[model samples]
Target chain A: MGMKLDEALVRARRALDKPAEFGPDLNVSEFAVVTGGNELALSRGRDRLSLVGVDLSDENRAGSYYQVDESVVGISAKMPGLTVLPFEHAIEEGIIENYVWELVPPDLDKYTALNAIYGRRGYVVVAERKRKIREPVQACLFMSSPGGIQVPHNVIIAEEGSELSVYTGCTIMPEVVGLHVGVTEIYVKHGAKVNFVMIHAWNEDAHVRPRTAVLVEEGGTYVEHYINMAPVASLQARPRVTLAGREAKAHLSSVIVAKGRSLMDFGGLIRLEGEETRGEIVSRVIAKDFARTTSRLRLEANGIGCRGHTECNGLMLSKRAQILTIPELLSSVSDAELTHEAAVGKLKEEEIYYLTARGIKRKEAISMLVRGFMNVRIEGLPSKLRRQIDLAIAMAAAGL
Target chain B: MRMTALYVRNLFVRSSGEKMILKNVSLELYSGERVLLLGPNGSGKSSLIQTIMGNPKYEVVSGEIYLNSERITDLPTEDRVSRGLGVIFQMSPVIRGISLRDLLVKVSKRSGVSLEDVRAVADELNATHLLDRSLNQGFSGGEMKKAELLLLFAQNPKIALIDEIDSGVDVDSLNSVGKVFQRLFSDENRTLLIVTHTGHIARYVGVNTAYVMINGRIVCKGDPKRILETIFKEGFNKCLECVGVGDEAR
Candidate 1:
């Protein structure tokens, strides 16, 4: 059940002064809530949607949800098997009350606290039982109001034996100073599968903190891919996924292009909590041009005959850039198998030489290597979405 | 007389750490000619090939290299490769992110070799399985050599400097690779300088001239049949003894 507004308000005030465990705390009071920007994020904003990977005139998507600063601007569902709605609307319909603040705590940190206080704009997507939706449900969170503050909470549910995919793109305008705090909760029922891809393209003067958590039941699978190739002043996020039933699986992969004096801390954690369950986390980071990033991946095995692994890889592209990777594996039972591997270094000189020797120019060869390094092939992804991810990888490799 | 395809004059080479590797070496390969460089182990034959290919790991301390009678001792590896100087290295490095198909796609554009031809060559060499794999990761010895040959075939360079093409190869793989070498040498306009210590490649391709290098110096240059027969009969010790007494033949 959804908590009342006064109780959430109390928790928000308690953690209002709480500093995050990573990155410097931005003064939340500097950014005031501005409501009436009246900007349709779809097309009039000079192709900002495409930059974050939303086609302006795409017919392949099953549905779309668009938000502009604290207001729901567009919601369209082309198929009858899916339900897409704004957060306040979903709450009013009593369709997603038990899912809000279910996976993520309201007062975990200042960002989540702020989201609990003022988060009524994000979308909620639900796939009915045994309904297979091939096309991805696309969502866009656009921030165009300068010096504005946005707090949104998102919820997604996949019923039993259903298959669904969602692509969420978060972006800001060319020259906007904003603060974005988004909290997301996802649930995958028995025998259902969900593939989620979230891409962020914020400008240089933005502060972004996104909190997300996922849960999978018996025989269900959940795959999540997060990519952020643009610049941000301060970015911090560490999403966790839990396999809560037998034979459940989860795959979490993230690619970050840290550049332009940016401070970024990225992470993913997978917990195997059921018998015969499996989980994996992979992170790829490319640091360049005076940027600093620390990536962490953790896997925990707490069930009988359970298995988990983590791979944390980072590449440094600049002499002044820095990257640090930490991989942790925890096993509680005697039969629980957990392993991890971490590597952080620059591109190999021999690999570059090999390509150049084949008559490819040095610049083109380096670009290819960087693009390959950032790619993480998600299994069973639709070809249409795979091409968009490839474009995103190419754009990220070209430069931020 | 045919035009000289590759020429090395008074060449002195050093490793990246400033230690000398090849000393005062001189050689030549004319267009449409196949020359075999037979040397003992650690005789600096591979170093010479590396120097000729403009690998920065091996620097030219002193001398000149001319490709197609044009001086190119000061050019970068990228420039030299674009000018049709191909090679099958003694050891192929592992390029983690690049696939054989990816490499061959670019080479096909430059060398004008169609993908159909590449597929045919790969099928003959049993290398079609490696087209989608990373350049050389987890490849067996035979597979590595075959991959190198596949790339050089797509390259179709003006001059091919093959190093140890016969080493660490099985009889079955050698048979397939020998077929590729024969096809490559069938072009009368192309040039070749094959380096091998075992002289196993002699069974496949004919050698017009042969040289035996010892202690970083070419001590003998003569007819291929005679030199190989002598080396096989009496062993390399005799050559070393003759050179120690300063009675080596050239």
Candidate 2:
């Protein structure tokens, strides 16, 4: 093992010793990793990976993968496949070896603990300069083994003037109990644009913690859309993005549904650190069936001519369900502008009555409103991916 | 056999915990009959129609409402709608995130009407451009009235309760709306109870009977032309005098 790996492992152990506090109510002390899907291991052990058996097909099957338990069973890539490789390979090839810990260090307890004991932690995708990859790169991470802990690290880099889009879905089998801690880092170079879409569909007992960070250089653009449409035991994630170059821009949005007694704490932070930088964060949350969700958004403008805005909206579906929204904006320079808006409430009775008066049942009317509330249009996404998102949203609303 | 299209007897209603808004209101509309209800603001004109449509906010202290000779006093709003009761609200609430097209689709499906018919209705109302827009959000007064009319057209109810549909509409839209109302009233099988303060709509569509409402009670009922002329020339006080309740009418 390299000296850096040895040092990272030691740091990881020390960080795990002092676990970071997620929230006052969530408990992650007794969680442990389990192993069960040997069939997945045998099938994935082959050299070539096919995503056919997992129900992912053409058009919807852009750069797909099936990660069961601690192993990646099937994996494939299309147009951008030539530049995609395991993170470990990237490290060995010295592509990002020195900058591995720069974005997300082992100082954070979750990252430390994940780096210490994770079984598989390597996937990186790169888009070369000035190349526009029209197709989305799709990936799926599934947890089938009960009580298993799955930790994966992903890195994506967009070179100068390049454009790329990625779609990632993380799910679990029925009735499975597991914890997923994923660390993702993205880098957008000068004049480049990157759009990232992540969909999380977990079982009722699955716990999820995702750590993500993005850095956009001068004149770069970054757009991210995160959606969680399934019921989970508990989920807590706070992603951050920094516009470190002049004239860079970023937009982050999330749509979440909390149901079945699940507890979710989701947040996003953006730091405008360069001149003429801009950022915005928008989150929409729906809570039902005794679920509790807290959404937090913060934007800080520290450089001259920087502008940022944050918006958070939530809907409560039941008396037992709860939703909390907190939006904050901070400006350190006189020329910087920051603003925020937040609202949490139940569907309007008048709106519901309007539909009911048209002969729609109250329940169906509420569902339609909820679906519409959760439908936050994202610009620049491919039509195919937008359709997939629409389907997922419909399924989620029907379940509610 | 003849059947009563709508019948309300001794209808008393209160809003939330407030005092009574509608007191001992009685109304009867025979099948194929058209009636005009005139009242000043806050005279329970909206409450009466909304109560008939089963708005739960208005507590029906003691009342009975029947549609097609079937009692619906205890039915829900949706059930009442299923029984062919439709209303055009005076001030329609904006429903965020739901497009007019989606709402019309749902309404058409539930009413057993085709999407093409709904579109045609919208086209007639000059609301085809609003199909993809959010329901009632940021719409002008004339546009909102047109949208409500389009929904009512799609509902194709046996009896339609139109509350001040002529208010706040432009002259051109008023003419168009009047033309539509004329066509709707041309169907001898359809019934209408239109609530208007200005009685401007009476000029466009024929009204068979007119009722003057004051202080939550109907003070007078007579020929639409005579009563409208009395209310227009000498105001509602004259109509109150005609009912021998001039002192009590507000």
Candidate 3:
């Protein structure tokens, strides 16, 4: 190996020895999770997990799969052409020999701490060129034990001309006090397409931070839809996508609900680095019951003929709730076009009256409006996944 | 004598800024009676209808409004709607992100009407094509009036307030709207209060009485045909002389 694993680990430790500061109000050094006396029963945890489309079972392992609970418990690939395994096993077998620690370096204190102390981490999915995976590769990273931290490193690669879909749900048992720091890296090669859907169903006492980055090559398309409608103590994530070759495209969307004094800071950035690259980012946030949420989207166009647009809208459902939206656009080349729009406000009274005047109750009217505000139509989603997302949105609206 | 359907007695209303908008307005309509409220611009015709519909913006400083002999001046707009009061505004606000189909479904569920009936009404208004679109979003004046009429038809309230439904509407839409009203008012238990400036709708629906309003006060009441013809040909100036108001009143 050009770089010894032990030496690379040491370097990562040195680089990320201290907790990184994100902003004035969101410094990680002051972040901590309080545990004990908050663990949920197994059945209850499984019930909560099912909300995100993860059904817990011990039957025969089917399709491409990875199920984690404190550690990687199950890994399989029923598909003949796909390769799936635990991270350490993949490393030992040389399947991950060339890519380990290369995409996500120990560049931040959170990552450094996780690398030094993580108990279970592994799962890499590779779809070779010309292969089209009809069934999605599903993974569930669940927290059943209280106060136990879960640090998972996931790497997904779609080789040239391949098409694949991935569905991942990360959830914690209700009242479980823990922290989850996951690092995900995805690569879409020439003429390949990758569709990724991630749902986070954390409890009110859980703190989550996910570091994700994607690179799309020539004629490649990457689409990502993320949802976090469950209550959480605090969440901070900023995922990025880079279009690095001609005609690369990326579309990123998120639907978030912050309730019950939760603090959420979420953002997405798309960088256009190649000629004729295009990108779009859209986010919808609903904050209620004293929850505080901040959503930001940044689009950067640096190449000729590049185009991008970013939209961030927030709805405040309570007087004590707060929402902050920041949409930014930057263009370096005169031919590159970039635009952004951001809005944050409570529901319009006129809309409420319009419904109530039709004899609908005031509460039902508000719920309908809130549901409509969060209903974002993402193109290219499978019918089943779309139905699951619709259910989650309806549940969130009802809870609010 | 016919039973009273809606009775507005000594009503005093104010705008949001506390300025009097409707002063000492009183009117009565019996069941199955169609009344035409005629006035020029800023004459408080809309304010009277809005106040009777329990709009909080038009504060009722005094007096009372009763729907079917049930006092509703203090009731909320929704409660008033539940008590058989429905209105079509002159200019309804656009409800963003709400589709016409969704609104109609909710109205159907609340008003005890079936979805099929709502669709039938929408089809009659030539608005079935607009059911999936956002409510009142980018709709022309005539379309807006038609949409409102669709909602009113679904609501099927005991007392219907049609505010300027004929204005800004095409001849065909006006005729269609008039036909629907004629069918609805054929029942002696239903009441109608139509507010208009042009009185062009008089050519379609039979109006039992016409009350001419000027400067927030009802100045004259007479037969609908005579009052509408006088106001249409000779202008409101001729009606002003019939009331004999002083400068302070103007």
Candidate 4:
């Protein structure tokens, strides 16, 4: 089922040329270079790499939407595994396997690798990864080259009754033309469960565009969470999932932190097509230091006894920081219940005063409040992941 | 006679380049003495208490304060509290997520005091019922004052600076608070510096001497019953005659 890997490389390079026109030197990491080929291999000292790309359609067919930049390095599945496919791969393979594709920015692009380029820019896996992977597969895409881009295509399939978790994050090295645009897709089988988390933090002057889509089978459950921590830039992405099977459940949560001239256009979409399906969408954003953010949520319920809920909360730290939230719900079945809510405001003075009265200084008071706000989500994550996330948040807050 | 348990000399408090709120206000506390500070609104009684507690918001222009022969004017709030000093703020300190019993336990442990003593004080102050509740969270004004009493009982500091325990308190709360103070100030080594405007607290909680403050200066000092009666009958006008306005509070 593995076609000529070189053709995919050629097609991806053409897409890379679009962003390359502004400045060829920007192309630090070349996507066409093959670092290592196997089920998975760690590459070091790469300028450009593309992680994954989806056909942007169900039938793995290829067209203009199939093109992506040099960040995602193209490679063949040397090992016989999941025979995975990008959204486009699904179209071409004629396998209606559940997956999603997105055109996210460079910062989000780094999310598909390990430590955002501690070694190489990104990674790719081609294995028959069916529902057996209990641990959430985490891929961190890190870019070391300045003004370079990475496109990663990630695919996960839960075989019948198999459960899995997937976490992906993107970080950029300093002065690097940090641009990462990525797409991811998750497929849950009958009675299977999948939890997906995406943490996005980009350097200043970086752009992020990420899209994700998931499909849940009969009695399957899916939980998706996206965290955006970017610096003085823009993040445009939409993660959507469909509960298409009977008794399927879907929960989506998102957090976005924008500071210093940063602009974020973030949102999520959920569809409940199965009977007795349940769906929840929660989003939070904090904008500070002359930053602007917009959050939107859309949910659809079509089956009897289906339920959907959406909430968007925004906290503006500085006067110049701006936020806009939109929460929308759609229900076709009368038996389904759908609700939506949205709010935007600054830190509460009473909460700050409360901490200060505890003998905490004013600055320390503010920091503790801010830490408390972020800790809500931090506490929910696993211990090791929470530590790394906290370090990154602290660095970003300090304007590093 | 016990030496001065607390002594403040030439104390001046200022904020934002302004004149001292407490202009050269000075006073002395002796062991086993409960001194009540009386003054009109903004007359510097609370300011005096805050300065002695080392609240960072108020800057002392020139002043020196001592507790049991050791100067504490330059100490931080926690350090002052560490040095056998306990204060109950005028406004109830609102706390959250910390249960009353847990906070009492933490304060006792940090103070290097016995938990059994804290428990006994909690029982005496009727705070045992509140042990399950969060510290000062959702507490009424009266309840919050009682919480302060509970803390003071558990702390058992050598010097206690109590601010407005009678203000905004019901009769029952006042009685309980007074009893708590009696238990706390039972030892001869303990000194009480209480700030209040009402004479009723003096009636309920006996004090050795009363200081009448007018516009930041301690204008008069006499027996608690006499000064409180004078202030009630004549207001601050009588205080002006006792100390010439020409001189600062000291």
Candidate 5:
């Protein structure tokens, strides 16, 4: 029997009957439309319904450069009427639990929606989907509210034996007030694989609180490389992962360049829960011109036959720049193999002399080595992403 | 007199929290001269070479080192390289995260040479195949030496301080390396100061002058034939106690 619109609306309402202090204004029954014409209306309707029209837009998102238009559409069970979420949702008696959404957009604004959701006390707003998407998802998080506060929630789930790549970035409007707090939780299911690249080049004053947590199932692998080349003064991020399955693995790589009195804190963790799990975490931080940076790593292996390696290295270019590295490894399994290394200092004068003896200038030599150190992790990235990251690094290092 | 390749006077070096490695030592090398420094393990031969190259690890207590009449003991290593100072280290060179081709290209560009010229030099040093790989990474012993030689040739330094050029090299590598040295010394104004204890290197590199160092001081100086003959028969112990006059009287 064909259901009536009233019945469908009632079903949707019942689906969203969960406890919400202040919802995004869902008083009317909106249809989950994918068409271009209806998508703008839907966006506008969402803004109006949520009383967020004063700051948000309703433009339809275009596909990523690598993907054709209208590739795929995702709808969330909680926001079933909105039509696009990142994970799969199953409706229970009156609410949806264990919901994982994947939002792969062609442009950058999807990141903005994510920020809006989390910025305004939106709960469990995961910005990414779990499925292995062939097309690239482009997202942009632009802070145009002028001192507006935002805390975005994003969860990434890679199912068993699946593969996915994500590219996300953030941009802040000038004189924008408030804070940008982002939390991301990643799950790599058994034998699954996920690669995440996040580019943080926000405005200088933007305070970003970015946190990521990942779980790896048996035989699954998760690789996350973050490039924090922004000139932002106050930025702190921690991307953590738990190897929960046998033979599960995770690698967290990051490169941070802080300059000009900026205070940056970079930290991450890798935990092995199952037997034979492997995890590697590497980080590089360069501070110059009175900047202060701290890079830390925490590795915990509980299961037998687990392996973990963590390294945190820092380079201080100026006399005023201060850098600290804290590397730790905790293992309960007798068979677990763990190693941690930390080093912080200026370039060895002998090394500079050696380079100069080859006719290289002192400044040029130091710049080359320091910049090269920052790009070492890019060697393992995909070609296109790696190139973009390299460009970004050069720009940041040049202080441009 | 024409400008010599290198000159040192009143050289003194001391290790950190340790005794002096070299005290008031003096040496000089004219253009195109192949010089050898023979010594026991504790001698300051390596220290002298690094000091001349301006290694920051070694502070010049009281000495004046000149390269072509220009004092450069205070300059950075890259500046020394610019002034025609090439070195073949005893151990591996630090590997940078760039392609060998780019490294060679960088050296060539700074040296005012064409890219093809760099390529030709790389080919001459048998490092052509390694140029596409990362700079000095995962290279075998022979290959690393060859790459070092290519870099040296690209720099085209007037003075070369070679530390144990024959160590860790097998017979086959010894011959190839010997031929390169022969070519390197063929041109005047490109001097070399080789440091080694083993006399087998004599068959590979033809030396014009030789000096034996013991206990941070040069004990004797002589022609290559006499030094090799003496070192082969008596070793560093008996030679340390002998004066340059004769082997018999104390």
Candidate 6:
């Protein structure tokens, strides 16, 4: 079960030379498959994780999953009616038989194909039927091996009438050159709810590609929040979610920070497919230094009485930095409502004057504004996790 | 001799667009004195206060400004603020991220006002709900004036330039704001330059001198009660006896 050479391997081989439709292409052969980690992961990994606001020792979390390179280092679940396990372990135990790549396919892209073949190290989270776990579950992936490739396939399932919350942080050690391709699929069954928060931090030498898809059934709610604050060489992610059942709802909020020569292309798409379903995609981006970002969010309404909205806002901090915001909305039914709004510009001078006139230094005023622009105020997050995210946003704003 | 807390002499001001907004304006605000600069719309009364506060939007093309006898014509807005200059713009722009509490703390740096002290002032002003919110974000007209007053209180400046503070405020809010003005006037160290078009604030706040501007020039200055009586009788009319003809405000 280590590696597959069947149709999965064939798909990986055929799409090995394929390039992503969005973001800069990464050379697949440029990185070595990380096979092991040195003593630093055993000794100082927690310290490095803490730098990005990842806390495993917090008792408020229902469970925690830690993965370094290609290995799953730690996994646990503290509450009943909840299951958290590594991808391989969950596969062996048959917990992800229906959720594994059911929403996201291998042929979607070269990265997904590679993930289906070499990405056996990730997390699996499942909430049993009618079980609403109050505490948030934590998952983290660490890419520390230099010039290495770390592929992870993550699956989350909230069974019928169940509720689950997860916070996933992907980070790397200082100055480590790595390529991380992560694939995730989330399933929200009837009357279930899922809150997923994924934050990534990396040095300037890393390139990341994350592929995710979510499906929300009838009377279910799916909320996703994504943030990438560290200076990465490049990051390209466009996760799509479908509201598949009547009265299903999905809200996707993304915070993107591009600095220090980083190139970030991030977007989200929400599809309202069922009657009376609703969806929204909101994104905020801060581009500084020589960084450049293209932020796009799209919403589609296909069923009667369904409505969707998409908004993309970007702030440019430097003359050399560039930001592009694209908002797309589509409605196939006459009764469906679709709207979009996009704005990409620098910090308003009136806002700066408002603070500077308050006796605050101009630089500090700009920093405060930058931090506020990055604040999305995600909904339905636990207090402990929300505090961690707030701290992380503050630290990221200060880093500039 | 009385100390001039804020002295502006022959100040010709222009906006960032190079349009002249203030022409040959001169005023003297003595310590412990609250003055009302009254005018109608487009009369440049707010421009005078903004020029004194060193808003980069309005540039002093010539002449000089002094605060507490120190030349501050060339200082930036932050420096002027640190020198005990406080102002509440007629319409404070929505600051997306900076909270009122954060701005209060930053502005109160020289005044040594702690966060608790700011909180206390917010409570007194009935603006505690705005303490944690982003400055001026989604605030009603009344809430905007109240929040600006809270910020001014946090600074506790020696000179306060309040523009149209009573315009959008309700009667209750005006009472609270008037109380804050009274507190400032109770001390001998504060100079007040309250700018208004309606001049209705005179009923709530006390002012020593009332200066009426027909266009960009101060045409008349006298006892607050007399000026009010004259203006209320005739409206913002041309007082050519004390001043000459002038152009419309920029």
Interface RMSD values for the candidates, listed in order? 1.6, 1.1, 1.6, 5.1, 2.2, 1.1
TM-score of each: 0.94, 0.89, 0.86, 0.57, 0.75, 0.94
Give one digit per residue, the lDDT tens place, for model 6 in A1-400. 3233255667666877788889888787788788676435834667667756678675788998888888777789999999998888888876677677778877777788778778878999999999999888988788778988889899999999999999888899888999899999999999999999888888899989999999999999998888888889999988999999999999898888899899999999988999999888889898889999987788888878998888788898889999988788777889998888788889888888777788888898888889989877666776776787788788888877
Q: Please give the fraction of native interface contacts (Cα pairs under 8 Å between A and B) kept by each candidate.
A: 0.52, 0.76, 0.57, 0.02, 0.63, 0.83
Write down the lDDT that model 2 would get: 0.79
- lDDT assessment of candidate 5: 0.63
The lDDT of each candidate is: 0.85, 0.79, 0.78, 0.63, 0.63, 0.83
Candidate 3: residue pairs that collide: A87-A122
lDDT of 1 by residue, B1-250 (tens): 6788899998888888776778788888888788888888988999898888877788888899999988999887778888888888889887765688888888888889998999999999999999988778889999999998988999988888899999999999999999998887788887889999899988788888887777677777677887788788888676666643222364
What value does the TM-score of chain B take for model 5? 0.87
All candidates: DockQ = 0.57, 0.63, 0.47, 0.10, 0.48, 0.71
> For model 1, how does the per-residue alpha-carbon lDDT over A24-129 read when each residue is reduced to its tens digit?
7888878877676454554566477787798656479998888888777788878888999888988889998778787898888888888888776898999999
Runs of candidate 3 exceeding 4 Å displacement: A1-11, A21-44, A57-66, A75-104, A112-122, A125-137, A158-164, A189-193, A218-221, A245-248, A274-277, B124-126, B138-143, B166-189, B198-204, B244-250
Model 2, residue A234: what's the lDDT? 84
- Candidate with maximal TM-score: 1
**What is the descending TM-score order?**
1, 6, 2, 3, 5, 4
What is candidate 3's TM-score against the reference?
Answer: 0.86
Error of 1 at A93 (Å): 1.7
- TM-scores of chain B alone in all candidate structures, in the order given: 0.94, 0.94, 0.93, 0.89, 0.87, 0.90
lDDT of 3 by residue, A172-231 (tens): 777767777787788999999888888888988888888788999999999898989888
Model 6 chain A weakest 10-residue run by lDDT: A1-10
lDDT of 2 at B72: 96
- Model 1 alpha-carbon miss at residue B86, Å: 0.7
Best by lDDT: 1
Q: Candidate 2 DockQ score?
A: 0.63
Best-first order by DockQ: 6, 2, 1, 5, 3, 4
**TM-score, prediction 4:** 0.57
